[model samples]
Target: MDDRSEGVIEPLPIRRLQESLINRIAAGEIIHRPASALKELLENCLDAGATSIRVTVKDGGLKLLQIQDNGCGIRRADLPILAERFTTSKLSTFSDLTRITTYGFRGEALASMSHVAHLSVVTKTKTETCAWKAHYLDGVLVAPKPGQTVEPKPCAGNDGTTIIIEDLFYNTPTRLSALRSPSEEYARILDVITKYAVHNPKVAFAGSPLPDLSTSSSSETSHAIRLLYGHSIAKDLLHSTFSSKKQDEAMEEESEVDDRESWKAEAHFTNANYQSKKMIFLLFINHRLVESSRMKRALEAVYSGVLPKGASPFIYLSLQINPRDVDVNVHPTKKEVHFLNEDGITDQISDTLQQALASQSHSRVFEYQTLLTGGIAEPEQSISKKRKGKERARDGDEDEDMENAETKTAASPPLKKTASQYKVRTSLQDRTLESMFPVINPTQIEGSSSGKGKPADISKSREIKESECYLTSVKTLRQNAIKGKHKQLTEILEKHTFVGIVDLNKCLSLIQHSTKLYLVNHGALAEELFYQLGLRQFGCFSRMKLQPPPPLRTLIEIAVELEETTAESGLTKPQIVDRIVETLVARREMLSEYFSFNITPTGLLESLPLLLRDYTPNLDKLPGLLMRLGPQVDWNSEKECFETFLRELAYFYVPGPLCSANPETEDQEAQDKAEKWQIQHVVFPALRRYVVAPKTLLDRDVVQIASLPDLYKVFERC
Candidate 1:
């Protein structure tokens, strides 16, 4: 006890860490690995408004890392403290942090690199006659060599910025040791660049000394993905655009600024046909490449139902959220970010993706019963022979006996099984009184002849029965569609009550049931109603006669030109055009009777359907509509023809884009308001009268408002 008291009498004194050591520690936090460091540097180039960014790396950027950008360069006056911590042109005050629009705002990337490595910059402003070169060590200017002046020197260079970093993490041996192999680091580097390339397809990326993995600046996102990823992933991609404007108005009203509350998300994802060993997720928030584990997991859950047990999908999403809603400083490296309503946004995006995948699956064409063809029979016979040989060996049968049995079977004529034999072999029973009747052979019937009389009568009966069955199936399917409509109507009438309009511009009306409010898409409702009305009023449509009765040849020519432009395999442009023209001409009378179109024999003038007199469609779309009808309509089936025709007509009745000219006078504003009021009062009432509620819209119950609670939850965040 005496020895302990003598040894531990004094406490160790506290002291400030040396600047070099402090800077090195901070640097280690920001640049954890080669990929993270490369991400920071790339962001800097984008922030500079560079159209093209070139990167060069040696030994996975541990030995040397360089980036050059053709953007606004650093001025000579700012060169001395260029690498200083907390220095940036993007932010002027602490308040700016709340709304950071730039990629690199904290000004830590360069400063951190300088502490762990030797940093140099060569920059020249557009107005500057000579470029200025500078060297930095630990956030301050230093000489390139010993005994040289510790100041920037004049040099010749392009009107841009060039940054060079050497010996990265040299002062932190532990961090250097923690890094992966150079090849692995290089792969990570490429992954980061590829994601950014997708986000900013207008920007070109080039690698020096390494493979020139560059993308064309003019390419679109799809093309860039094809170039970087591969054709396999690109071919199976499904695209969807989601916006917050699609949400209930009550949710959006909670935000102080309406415009700021609205956000848009675009996703390009692989369908069920495409799979990978691991999920390749590239997410960008406001064009800044970032990661969100919550988003990744949510998206993976969506694919879990679509893909095989051990497979995943490729997803690239770009989200544009208001600056104030996003906290970019949550992580030191800014590799991840926290945004307002993270859970709500993620759920919405995941739901949208799932809906897209479901739709894609529904559109797939399956080849059923193809194995019944002769081409498949050969393989089946071979497999059966192999199985029989194995069975004989297992049973210890002699090969000679097996050969003799096969030869006997081959020599004998094949036996035709009678109807009684078929009935005895099958377990299925007709559960009706008809099952009690004995099977009668057609050849043995009363009017039977030795040759053709009974056989001809049996063939005629079978054909008549098949035709009846086919017609019955068609009738059943149509009845099912009608039943579905009736079921939706019953649910809506029983469960929901009409509420006031929320947004007439978007045709969104709020309806409440119990404590929840649902946003109804009146636009979609109107389209469905118009289609139903057309079907009900077939062959008696009201006509909107053209003033001068335009030449039908003109419409035919337009269709021909469109067909030529979008021609597909197995059909020549001229052949498609000729077929379309001939088909329309042949069906002219039928079109006139059913659709109220009046055309002359020599291809002249037609009247269109007068759906809603107040709503005028964009006449410019008429030719394209006719062109699609030629190919999309099923001419072979009467049911499909009617359904497709009604759908096209409904599409034609939908409203077009509003004029965007400035409404400078009160009269113009009043007229706009009056139009919206008319839509709400006249159009919506008429639509509700005819339109039955749909089972689903965008993977959600159309009339029930099942997700109304989720909408309320989103507003709570606001």
Candidate 2:
């Protein structure tokens, strides 16, 4: 052929396609596979106000798919044209589309099914005495058998409707071939039903071929989630509900009519504790399941800050907007939809859910634990080397250091602390405070001259001696604490999320419990913890031996010198010193036997009782503690003496103000950081596990700062 002949193409005359072929092509656009057909039928059942739905599938719905619902049945006259396109009871005029709320408005579901598959319907209204059954092929009623009349036949049935589709995609072989295996198709069917079940928890649903796919009516969203998903996902789930409403610019113009721009959203999402490799997202607009890649990406971005890398969260979000504001006819299968204020709505929802997840104690605790455990364990030498490198990088900029630390934590997997790991154990057998917050490097230690002493051997393997005496006085003190414990405060401490220190000089820290934020005076809380430990341990206190024990008289002299500057007393400093030394020495045997306060025969203060593991009391406060024991105690009464003495010891062990008040120098800043690390890691974690916060702490130590609901109300008014 010549080049001119090849380039000269003739246009064919246009002609209308055959009606049968035209209907078949339109049907293929709506019903792509077995799952698509099932989706349409399920929606039709729901639109009819069906509360209970039962489904049966064969060969993944390729061979047969049946659905029975106890809904308002069809009329006898409507059966003739029920499978015809555009014959729907849901709409009448063009304006009806604006306010359409029903799932099926196009009325193409049954008609589409008829063109590609064998379709039939069985129905009976409440007013009718019996049910009627009809069969259809290619959008028209057909005879059930050869030479039979082409009309509905009366049958026995309940007051409902049943739809059955046979040999789906039999005529459209290409669509059928594009589908997955039977098991895979079945899995997709189950997934669709599960999401609908969670959204419409009040409606009952049953799927045959497996018992696990059934859900009962009158259930809650949380229960449905727990039933369909595993308990692991349910336990770590977070829920949030948000809405948007435009306020009238003029009060005089405001009417009683509802706002057309208003929209509401409800969501159930997993927290940081629950993570998977792939995201499980279910989005429904106006109760119709749909997909929006923009919305999905927005949600995934919200969890990125909380969950580790390569992990995602499970989210179920349902949005209800004014029908006039949403365009439901954007997709042939109604799977993808568009609405007004789509970007604004997505942002509002993402923010609300992000706030909810951030407030979860589980997520906060998980992050805290990750930082403490360094995510996964490693050799001691390796950890030290890595920490050294980080220290150099974190030297001058405190905020940058925190940012880097959080980035590392966000990249690491969550560590689970189960119930078995927190079982109450003997002090000697328990994990030490130092393990959670390791001691600072030698350079930092050398920079501080205040409160300096040899840190205790806090290793888990360290051996120490403890008192074994069990006395009645100690038992009474323990019983009093148990009787006076506060129920609400106990729960709060047990599940609190540790926020960082608010005022390091005041020993004040922030913590979140449930949706409430609280300011905790950890210094005061620590005193209670140590006091309780002393009571419980009674004679079981671990001993902290003092090297080259100081003489009792010498300790008294130091106390006298410190007291001279602040005390206004009748007795002189020398007189006060002599009295305290004599009183303590006289009661040496009693102190050693029950309180683990060892005093040598030569009037030397040998050792002190260790109340908390790996926690050493400030040696600087020892003189003040010894001085207080003499004057504060009623030595004559057995109960009074033990109570006052233990109180003094607990007071001494409570951490004092940070040494570097200004933090102007490098050494001072390092000291502040080290102090903060110990309080956040060692002290707060111990309180979470062991202490039972009493009601007294509410007024004196734990102060409620804010609550989630209250904050929302304030913002709404603004």
Candidate 3:
């Protein structure tokens, strides 16, 4: 037809003739890009509980985006009209949208997709003897392709549906042009998959070049991540457990008691260690694939007192609240949602996350000692696997160079002491992250919310409510606080989001430092546990006999005052000793700080009986014994232990507990306490020094030093 004859006579847009074409145009409106389209289909498959998902993408779904599922398949009779607009089997009436829990609703995803893309529905009903194949164009049943007509053919297949979207946006060039590169597009896909993969651990997801797949995506993803890590992410890993019950309780408590709860709530407590992103999977209850600004801000606030100022986390939160809780009709592409309990949900989530995170215990085991010599290998296994894999075979010098370049970036790993830990996260991870999950990157807190210098103060951080996950009971919460006053885990105990475990080698790669244990949280785990346990519940009080040491006293003073103490009292030797003792006794965590220490989910603990075996009712009692025992004594009573600790603090002021002890001990208190502070602040890099570098952890004295730079060549060569 001539241009003049076409519906577009100049100004007004050209309108399609048939209703099917009209429906197809509408379909395009719903299914905007490859990622958006994939989101809808994936939702459906997930709702069906398919354990394994295989996603094949070409040109980011422009050429073809195929997803096959093993869920209950579709009926043959419905195949012809499946592509039609406003048709769905998930719900029969309009009321369903109010409680639409499934991923697909509005009956528009398939219909809208059919409009602009070549659609194929190959489905086999669970009861059907064979699968039926049908094709559609412009939301209407038609030949599979042009000029091809064959009745829906029977094919052998398992129970499920495979949806193929071909020539996406074939009708709209402008939209397609806005898409990113293949790697970038795939990144978005990976983003989508990652959110789903972690959210539903029961389900496995993988994506590889079509017809060129070998290993599992999780394995491949883990390895590729290793290549990008430049430095190991974690070491000293332990098992973890996550229960939605805690999340739900938190949700309910917020909605009811705190009045911050939402129309619906879901909590998740995972028993597995996560890599460094502080991973979170967020799925808003009422909306699909979107983020509310308020929600983000709310999340930030909840984590504010808990996480450091700049640090954030990788969270995959799936919220299932009343539809009225959120307005999904806000965005054209549905990337944003309006939440009802925006503040409530965010607070609940952040608080819950804080608690979940605070429960982290790092005493994870590695190097299994079996009668037959068997245990889960170290994370370096991933590094070694890289050398033996196809990546080593196919991606030669050029790829290595590119990776080296990526490593040099802010995210890359750098050279450090052999006994030190890596920097945790680098830019290499940032670049490779998208390849693993293309749509959205995982949450990262390093340099983001790391609570750099004194975040307000412990008092201010304590001002917020303690999350449920970290609390054993209200009384226990109170007891925990009392316990923490003796030690100083206030900074680490309050957040919920522990990074994954790492081995000594991996630990050295991630951080350039020596730390028997360390934690980076906005709040302290000891303090958080205090609130969770509700110390009031535990009437038994083993009061802190020790005072803060000099250096620790200064830090605590700064935290409390946000200013340096200029008073002569702060400079007094006796006062300095008091502060250090109190801080150490109170803040120690039994679980390993190194991420590689693997421990049982429940067995992982912050306190060990051995560490708490000694105490003293009176500080004077320790000195009498020091006179008899030559000052340095490992007391055995719970009460005497506390006193012995206090005596150390007294040393901070006057050098006496060690006066009768070793000749080098008098001045060591100040230096050691100062060093510990440096490690605590993350200001000093950690370093471990061994005599002769044994192949594994078993070979070293494993002295926890303050900084990597402190590692002597003797230590390094060891």
Number of the candidate with higher TM-score, 1 or 3: 1
Of the candidates shown, which would achieve the greatest lDDT relative to the real structure? 2
Report the C-alpha lDDT of model 2 over 346-384, residue by residue, as the tens digit.
999998898898777544344211111011112234434
CA lDDT of every candidate: 0.69, 0.77, 0.45
The better-scoring model by TM-score among 2 and 3 is 2
User: RMSD of model 1, in Å?
Assistant: 24.3
Cα miss at 277, model 1 (Å)?
0.7
Q: Can you rank all candidates by TM-score, best first? A: 2, 1, 3
TM-score of every model versus the real structure: 0.50, 0.51, 0.43
Which whole-number lDDT from 0 to 100 does residue 75 have in model 1?
90
Alpha-carbon shift of residue 65 in model 2 (angstroms) = 0.6
Candidate 3 lDDT score at position 121: 82
All predictions: root-mean-square deviation over Cα? 24.3, 27.0, 26.8
Query: Which residue pairs show collisions in model 1?
Result: none
Q: Which stretches of candidate 1 lie over 4 Å from their true place?
A: 1-10, 247-257, 362-718
TM-score of predicted model 3? 0.43
Per-residue lDDT over 1-718 for candidate 1, one digit per residue giving the tens place of the 0 to 100 score: 6756677665679999998888888888898887788899888888877766778889888888888876778999999888998898989988897789899898888999899889999998878999999999999999999999989999987657889989988888888888899888888887888788888887768775444366645578988887678656886888889888846678667754366667899999999888789899999998888889999999999989878799999999999999888888889988789888899889999999988888776544432211100110122233345545544454454545655676455569864222111121111122322224464442232223345532112222211111122344345534545765645343443344445455545556654443344556666666676776665556666688877877765665675675433332235766656666676778888789777867767766568876653445557667766665675555646776776677777866654333353566765555444444444444554554545544433221133333332333355458
Model 2: residues >4 Å from true position, as ranges? 1-4, 246-258, 361-718
Candidates 2 and 3: which is better by lDDT? 2
